[model samples]
Target: MHELGIMTGVMESVETAARDAGATRVLEVRLTVGEMTEAIPDALEFAFEALSEQNELFDGAKLLITMVKPHSCCLACGAEFDHDRFHMFCPQCDSFALELLAGRELHIDSIEVDLPDD
Candidate 1:
């Protein structure tokens, strides 16, 4: 799955950070993903687990994901509202002309690691 590649990138980035900070091992990872990004949490978790088992630094690391719903503003009425995935329209003016304000993000929020001295 594409999630495997995504998870690999995430682990690589976090591992670099953890190593730079003198960490011996990663303990946890927190990520923020938007609905519009279409990254499945379950699949992401599976990928993470699979990668963790293959990596020495992330063998026991935990992954925590936070989902952000799509938020949009109607271009016609300038009204902001949550975008419904099924309808794909602005609720305020019922218009299809919308500017997405959020829900297209995928980033690491935080990482917990075991420092050499700790």
Candidate 2:
């Protein structure tokens, strides 16, 4: 699954951030995933667990995932609506022309870290 690669990138970024911030350890990570992303939360969790074991920075760190629903705007009627992955049409105008406003995002929202005692 691509989740492994994605989680790898996430860990790298987190570690880099923690290092740059002079943090002793990473406590938690929150990721925002859109409906359009094929990455599964469970799969990502599995990857994170497997990959984070060797790194003390992420040891015992909690992984939190937030899922976002897809929203689109109808080009014809200029109407915005929430829709599922299977549909990409306007509800009001029933037109196939649609502009995706959301549901294609995959990024780290926030990271909790334990700073070194100054």
Q: What is the lDDT of candidate 1?
A: 0.89
Residue 3 displacement (Å), model 2: 0.8
- Displacement of residue 76 (Cα, Å) in model 1 is 0.5
Q: 1-118, model 1: which lDDT tens digit per residue?
A: 7788888999999999999999999999999988887889999999999888888999788999999999888899999888646667876667899888989889999999998764
lDDT of 2 by residue, 8-115 (tens): 999999999999999999999999999888778899999999988989989999999998899999989999999989988898989999998999899999999999
The TM-score obtained by model 2 is: 0.95
Segments of candidate 2 deviating more than 4 angstroms = none
TM-score of each: 0.94, 0.95
Relative to the unseen true structure, what is the C-alpha lDDT of residue 61 in candidate 1, on a scale of 0 to 100? Answer: 89
